[model samples]
Each structure stands twice: as structure tokens, then as C-alpha cells.
Target: MDMGRYLFRQVRGSDAAAIYELAVANEYHSDNLPLNRSLIKAYVQRSVKDFAIISSSGVCKNPLYMFVLEDTYTRTVVGVSQIKNILWRLLYQLRLDPFLGENIGKLALKKEDGTWELGGLLLSKEVRGGKLGKLLSYGRLAYLMSKGLAPRMLISGFLKNTFWEYIAIRIGVSKEYNPDKHWRSFKTLTKFMGLLPAHILLAETGIAFGYFEDLFKIPIPIKPESEPARKLLVDMGLCFLKEIEANGILWHGAPWKVIRDDNFMRYKVPQDTIEVDTCKTSCHLDIGMAVLPSDDFRAQYIPVAKLEDGRVYISKKDFSCGKPKHLFIFETKNV
Candidate 1:
């Protein structure tokens, strides 16, 4: 068996090829996502350049990011999620023709209070609902915490007619809002977008392709449905936000929900492996970082430490922003 280990890192331009494959898989099931080979390639290049500049120079930061789940042994990109330091809302004037004037939406993140949003949680068949999801999701939070950009609330939207959206509606954290006044057009667009080849669709848009892609990011409205999951969020103290939602043709129908829990950070950080003794020349943690137990009892990100005299040693504290820095990868057979 080829040994493999999982890792979370800032995406680079070189990852475009691998990530394109992953995006294809995601677009296969979720038709509303406006990701194509050309767009993803562009996304990779743009994001890599931006992250490098941000990571090193801290200038002209876009605050728009995509994090990938990698299998180091195979050198494959398995999954991806997007993060934004701001949320842009579409603002359009209801004109003589609603569709014609739909061009007035903020294509930038919200700058007030510096609220960050987490979206685009796409995982591979091998990792969805598994430990990798937790690691990837929490990893974003960890990175944000390190940069002191952690938001008091993390916001996201679920697509219509999905199990995840079903649960979200039930939890009462979000409600569905639809814009375009004529939701019929909106429905037709989503329904038909997935029916055709992605490349053809992109070509059809011509110079307007980028703008179309941004519109796809907006969450469509979903009807409120009751479910047991709603009670759990209520118990956890999560509340729905009536004000400050994405306003425009972009997210007219999706109910924007917010979660507030100071205690939620505990679950996003790897408390078990984030600490290491810096006093010794070298020290060994029982397991290297991110070597957590998966949902099916399989080990994800299993770390391999060289054992001399059956001991592990390391020097320097493994922490950033007062929290444990996450593990990248280690050789292992687990996948």
C-alpha cells in the first residue's frame, strides 16, 4: 500500500492542475457551483499569488481564500473550501425590467466589524463526514485565530434541495430568500446550468464569465422546514439573524443565518496535539499534529516520528497566535 498523510496549507498556483480534478468531482454533484477548468485554474493562480503576497508581505490582501485537503503520499488534492474575510451583498434597483438592472451588487467583502465568512465546503467521497472534514474545517479556524482574524460568528449558506440545506432550515439558523423578483427565472437558471457542458457555458458568457461565476456563489433561497436538528442549534445558543443579510438578486431567497458561541473555538482547534515542550533540544509528542481518529476508527493524518530509544524529542514550542500550529503531513499507510 502506498503510504499517505493529509495536510492543510495555503493553496499555491502550482496546485491548479490537481485542484482542477477535485473541482470537477465537486461540480459533478453540485451544479450550482460555477467552477470550471478555466475558472479553477484562474482561481488557483490568483489565490496562490495573493496568498504568497499576503503571507510574506501582508500587503494588498484580498481576504478571499481557498484551502485544499492534500494527500502528501499520493500528492493529490482531495478536497477544498473557500474563506472570505467579507461578505458582499447585491443591491439592485427594481427597475422596469428586473433582470436587466441586476448589475448592482457589491462584489467585495463586508468591511464593517471585520466579519469573516466560511463557505465552499466540498470534500471527496473518501473524506466527507470523516475526520478530514473536521480537520479541514477547523484548520481554517485555526489559521484565522493565528492571524487574529477570527470572527465572533462564522456564516455560510446551504443550497436548496439538499440534505445539508434541509438540516440548516430545520435548525432555524437560516431562512430562504429569493431575489430577481421573478424567482422562476432564478430556478430555471439553476436547473439548466447543470445540464450543459461547463466549458461551453463559460464560452457562452464571453467577457461576462467572471461576473456570472460570482453570482453563482450567492446562496439561493430555501423554504423553512422544521426538523430535529433545529433544536440542537437552539440548545447550542445559535440564533438566526434577521438583519444584515446578503441583499440583492444574488442571495434574494436564501435566509442568512449566524452562529454565536465563544465556546465553539474549542472544537475547531486540535487541543490534543497543539502543544509541545520547547525546553528540550527535541521532544516527541505521542503522535505528531493532526493525527486524529477518524469517524470510522481509521487514523487520518497519522504522523510518523523517528523513534530513537523509543522516545520522541523536539525543540521549540509548537504554537502560533497562542494556539497550537497545525500539523502538515507525516508518512503513513492510512488514507
Candidate 2:
């Protein structure tokens, strides 16, 4: 989809080079977006295949969609957004009462239908402002709801390194935290524990666990880079699920129905042309993303739209090529 000087489309194999460059440039802050060339290429290939399969059969064993935003002026990719099946894992959160040192409870991972994760949003520093980031982020949901691929539940992870920071403090070292430090400490701690008898070790489990009891007490510093993404997730209706925390980062989750209702997920095809209002005047016009339902999906910003008879009316110029089967319509805030 064309957004003036920018374009949004599904990732193609040809975009591997541009995406690799984008990843390398943002390596310092890269979350899910990898910096490896081969890994990025494989992701592009899988994304292309997954999109094709889902468009055709409406099913894929491992679904993953990677969307790219390109600068039309330079014909180079500038931003990326990703959607993938949620990775389910079984793990326990070791907690101890700060005062009494008692175990709270262990949690087992559960699976649910229609669950997906929205993350891996990265943009070039040059195109960091404006609504470009929102377009790349929300446009993925627009496409999913348009194609009936919307997840029943959506999850998002923020503050990538905050988990490691928590671990650093638990190890009694903050600034000097690394793999070497962790490995050395792990060896020393295990060897010391090995010397204790089974009964003694079992009895001291509470004391051993108490070392990390300060997990929740410490204030986590939110990274400046992840603040915007977190805000977008909150705006999308996701809330913190206190039960889950991976790598020190708390995951946010919400039902798809909640997001759908909050975003006004009513969709329709434009029967006739309507004037595209830029909302520059005092008059108010709702902004949303218009997605073309086709094998080659394309989505762009729609500044003004009229919802009537459960059908959306948009500017004829937006669909100059031909009439589309469906247009994904959603209400957006602050553009």
C-alpha cells in the first residue's frame, strides 16, 4: 500500500538484502529482528511461503508474517513488523516470600486456540517520527482481521533486556554482567551446593531461592526504545498478565474480541467513491488502514471513511486499479 513517500507490503525474498542492512544498523536495539543475514533470508522465505499458504488454504502449520515498510523515494526498506504463532513453553517462576521465604506456587504453560504474538517492530532512525511506526504496527492486525487470521488472543513483549538486568542484580553484580560471569558463578554455586548432603540441600532450598526474592521489588528501567511500542500495545487494549514473565520482561495479553471491539473491526467494500478528507479542517474524520483483500495484499492509511449499511465508502482514487473484494476498516487514534 502506498502512503505518500512510503509503501507497505508483504516481505519478499528480494527484500532480504535491504532488511539485513536495516537489522545491522539497529543491532544495538534489535529485539526479535535478527542481525544475521542467513537468518533474515530464511525468515523472509518462510514469511513468503506462509503468506501464500494462508491465502490459498487458509491454514499453515507454522504461520509467520513479516511486513516491511519501504521508502518509495529511495526504494529501500525502512521499517518492519512481524506476527507469528505463540511459542508455548513449560517453565516455573521460582519465588520466595521476602520475609518468610515460602514458595507461592508453580505455573504450567497452557495452550489456547487462535493465539498469536505481535512483535519485532523496528524502524530506521531517519523515519522514526510521524505515524509510520503505527502504520507498520497496526497494519499487521488490519491485514490479519481482514483475512480472518486474527488471533483469539494477542501477546506482546517489551523492554527486551530488562530481564537480564534483573538477573544481574540477583547475581550480586549489576554492571559486570555477562555470559562469562554467569558461567563462572553457575559453576561455583553448583559445586558448593554439591558438597551439601541431600537432606541439608533440600532443607536449604528456601534459603537458596531467597537470593532472587527481590525480583518484583526492584524497579525496572524501561528502555526508551520500547516505550512507544508499549504505548501502542496499551492503546490496542492489551494489559499486563502478571502470571507470565519471560527473561524479566512481562508479557501483555488480551482477547482478540476486546481488540476488535476497541478498534472498530467492521469491514466492507466501497460501493461508490467518497471524498478523501484529510481531516485538516475543524471537521472530524476517523482514520483507519484500508487493506485490499487479495493474494498480493496491500494496505494504506485511510484518512476519512463513512460506515453505512455495514459497507465502507472510501475515495475512488484509493482503488484506482480495480474494485477489491474487501477492505479492512479500523478506527485509529491520533493517526
- Tens-place lDDT per residue, model 2, 145-261, is 667776778887653354455555555556565432332254433333233222100012211111123334443445666667777777778876544233334467898888876
Question: What's the CA error at residue 252 for candidate 2, in Å?
Answer: 0.8
lDDT, each prediction: 0.42, 0.61
Model 1: residues with Cα > 4 Å off, grouped in runs: 1-4, 28-33, 91-113, 150-153, 161-238, 242-261, 267-335
Q: On a 0 to 100 scale, what is the lDDT of residue 288 in model 2?
A: 44
**Residues 17-116, model 1: lDDT tens digits:** 7766776765532222235666667766776665665657475445667778778777887877666654343212222226553333222223434455
Count residue pairs with overlapping backbones in model 1.
19
Model 1: lDDT to the true structure: 0.42
Scored against the true structure, residue 297 in model 1 reaches a CA lDDT of 11
